[model samples]
Target chain A: MRLIFMIAVLAAGLLYTFYAFNTLNFLSASGRLGPGFFPQILGLGIVSMTLISVITEARRMRATTNYFAAPADAFPGSALLIICMSVLYLIGLRLFGAIPGSIVFLLAMFWMISRGKPILNTVIAVMAPVLIYLLFRQLLSASMPEGLIPLPF
Target chain B: MEIFSDLMMGMSVALHPANLLYLLVGAFVGMTIGVIPGFGPAAGIALLLPVTFGMDPVGAVMMLSAIYYGAMYGGSITAILINTPGDAGSVASTLDGFPLAQQGRAGPALVMQAVASFTGGTVGVILITLLAPLFSQVARNFGPPEYFLLAIMGMLTLIVMIGGNWRLGVISALIGFALGTVGVDLESGRSRYTFGSAELIGGINFIPVAIGLFGLGELFFAFYSGSHKKRDGEMLTYDGKSNFWPNARDFIETRFTLVRGSIIGFVVGVIPGAGAAIAALIAYSVERSVSPRPENFGKGEMAGLVAPEAANNAASSGAMIPLLTLGIPGSASTAILLAAFLMWGLRPGPLLMEQNPEFAWGLIASMYLGNMALLLISIFAIPVFVLILKVPYRILAPLVVVVCTLGTFSVNSSYMEMYIMLGAGVIGFFMRLYGFSPAAVVLALVLGPLAEESLRQTLTISRGSFGIFITRPASLSIIVVTIALLVLLPLIQLYGQRVRKPKAS
Candidate 1:
């Protein structure tokens, strides 16, 4: 898994390096380094480092079964659920209004993470967003997105 | 005379009702996070960065700084009673603190930690009050080459001295430098990597990236790592039987030790990359060496408890001097504060004292008030902190997610920034899994652009001659240090290994 993760990073670095080399202009007509110089340098560095990381990871994998001392299963289903919930919450915040969207998002999250206490989860789900709304919108006067439902602060 | 008058003006600002309230709140939040065993001061301050958007810069800094030292005070509570160091800095505390707890003297251990922390923090502030002006005076003479070299030296120190895989640290910093390039170029007036998006012209906002990386990334980690899962530990219940306050004899015995640790911590704090954890460890070793009862150092010795606790708090304050005087962060917490300074359009340096003396001196003044606030809170607020620990991660996690998402959005009301935050959070999660230092990346993100700008400006001034850096004495010295750290030290180590190999053969 660690090797695969490194491989992916190496691939990304290579692609970014290729794109930067092709598209970005490193030197201007005036003969000085342009805006692209630093990015190209960074891209090249990333490629070299990621390549080194891949080789190092492969050598360690060959030396031992438990190379990185990582957990047997670091990513469980709850983690996946949380990730999905985060994406869904982001989408909801854009589609619905900030307050209404957050209320639903909070309730769903509270329901999932709570210890099967519906009443407590529900109360928290309702109160948490309202308090946050009051803090950000009313107190801080932040300009939140007004989508389907306009929140009256 | 000018410094005194400026400090008085700062005192008035810090004493304002609004700023005072925030200081109390920040201290409470800091303590809460400290006792919880996972949420350290870095995340606590990062979590609250957005909320400070509405606040004045002085108040914002005052509140955030209160959280930093307050967390130090709170971490000792758990270290002494529960026998678990709240953060790495408090690991030394557990050496003697837990043993004292086992001996049923937990109350006295806690009292000593608070007093030691107060003493150290007070001394650190005093040192800062004295030393910051001298440092600022020196900093005023620095040019672009010096600034460039300073940034390089700062990055090198962070990458090498953080006691991790240096390779990963470099990669993390490179990644940050890459991200920093995503915005429009300041000098060339050209877009580097915006990919033709209009919103990209304004660049990636620091607040969302910060909130996502530290706040959401931490929550994501907790879910996967099970760090927030309840562990079995004996919680010491206070019965109001033991003396809560340290006796005069206790202070008299530990006074020199406290002073020594404070000075060590303050000096260490001013240097980049060495933070409270290193200070605490070094202070513990120094105290053990100097003590007559060296063998009793970790055996519930009073000096053991006082040394590291004082050192960590002192180091926390000491870390601020560089951040305030030079616009360079010495540690992760200071990096977040620097981000706040940038967000407020307030650059910290010698000119900050000249142009915005109220904001500059106000922060220093608030440190005094914050230390006093932490002393009072640490004595009277342990139960409150303990109660906060009872709020299960199940509830806490969701609330954090809401806060982070909302905070990210509130920065610019741009859904694109929120999405960028989400992406940064994911990247941060993987970076942590891969042993990359998120703090290194953050420091790079905050300093990389400034460093790049300075480098370019120096080049322009030198008419593209690379010799400009070496021509300047200050820049040359800093460049020499960077080379030693990045190159010479490694070669020497490799040579040592080769000589040892031949001996073994």
Candidate 2:
């Protein structure tokens, strides 16, 4: 998994360097260092460094027989679930607006994580969103996602 | 004498009702953030950055800076009580802190830590009062070559401090430099990586990226580590029923320790990338070596707790010097503070003092009052923080996600930025999991543009001569210091490791 992540970074670095070389000019029309100069250096640095990292990681994995084993306490499933819920929450915000979407997401998340305390979860879900609305929308005058179905408030 | 009047004027500005209120709120919030294990001042300040948008720049910065140092004070609470250092800086405190608690001396340990922190923080502020203007004066003579070298020096020092993971740290910094290359080129008026999007023209906003990386990334990493599933096992209780305050002998024993820790911590803190954690560990080592009762060290020794408590707080204060004088952040938390300063249109370099004396001095003045307030709060508000610790990570995790999302969205009202934030968060989690430094990434992102611009200007002046860096006296000085730090820091790190390894076994 670590090697895969490093390889992915290497691929991105290659694309970034490719753009630097092909699209951006190394020197400006005035003969000064241009946009590509720094990017070229950074891109090369990233690709080379990440490649070394990948090789080092691969060697370590090969050396260790239990390299593939997960730690006893790791909860990758819970993290993935939370991440998926966050994505859905964002989509829900686009569909149902900030206040309503947040309430529903929080309530559902509390239900999933905390469990067995519906009333407490419901109160927190409702109160948290309302406080956030007052703080951001009313007090700070910052914009919130109004969504397609905007609330009357 | 002039510094005195300046501080007086600053005190007047900081004494404003609104600014005072902001300071108190900031100190409280900072302490609260510190009590949570794994969350540090960087995450707290980043998460709260958007909320300061509507505030006056002076008040907002005061609050943020309060959060920065207040966290150092608060981190010791958990170290003493639960043996879990709230942040890296507090890790040294856990050496003697938890042992003291186990010995039923939790009250004295708690009170002594607060006093030591206060002493360190206050002494550090005094040094800043005496030294910042001089540092600023020296920096005023620096040119483009010097600025570029300073940025390089900062990055190299940070990477070198990453020890065995130096390659990963370099990659992280390079990634930051890449992100900084987005938006239109200021010098040539060309778009490099925007992909023709209008939103990308202004480049990546630091607020969202900072919030996502430190805030959401840490939360995700905490979940992955199964922190939510773990129970808080038998926290040592401090009822204040007996021996709550340190005796005269305790004070007498630690008097020299406090002064030594403060000076050592301050000196270490001024060096870029040598943060509070390193300062605390070094102070602990120094105190042990110097003490007559060295054998008693790490076995509920008061000086053990006092030395690190003072050193960490002082180091936090010392970090502000570089940020204020050189426009270079020493650590991730200070980097966010730098972003906040930029957001408010307040450039923090030499001229910041001459042009915005009120803003600069007011921030300095607020620290004095902030330390006093934190001392009182750290003592009296123990129960409140203890109660906060009881709240399970499982219940707190979801709410934090909501806050991170909302905070990122509120900044620009752009879904693209939110998406960027989410992407950064996932990357941040992976980076943390893989021994990469998110702090390095954020620091590079902040410094990349400056470095590029300085390098361009230097080359232009020297007619593309690379020798221009060596020709400039200031640049040469920075290079020498960078080299010296590179040599010395590892040895200091080795000493710290030697101190810890014996105890751990």
Q: Write the per-residue lDDT of candidate 1 for residues B338-445, one digit (tens) a residue.
A: 988888898998777889888888888888888888888887776676566556777778788888888877877888988988887777777776788777778788
* lDDT winner: 2
| Cα shift from native, residue B218, model 2 (Å) | 0.8
**Model 2 residue B229 lDDT score:** 80
lDDT of 2 by residue, B1-505 (tens): 9999999999999999999999999999999989887788898898888888899999999999999888888888989988988888999999999998888889889989999999999999999999999999999999899988888888888888777688899999999889999999999999979998999998998877888888888888888988788664346466557678778999999999999999989988898888898999999999999999988877889999999999999999999999999898888899899999998999999988999999999999999999999999999898898888888887788888888888888999988888888888889999999889898999999998999999999999999998988988888889999999999988998899999886787
TM-score of 1: 0.91
Q: How well is candidate 1 docked (DockQ)?
A: 0.63
TM-score of 2: 0.98
lDDT of the structure predicted as candidate 1: 0.78
Report how far off residue B262 is in candidate 2 (Å).
Answer: 0.7
Predictions' DockQ, in order: 0.63, 0.81
Fnat computed for model 1: 0.68
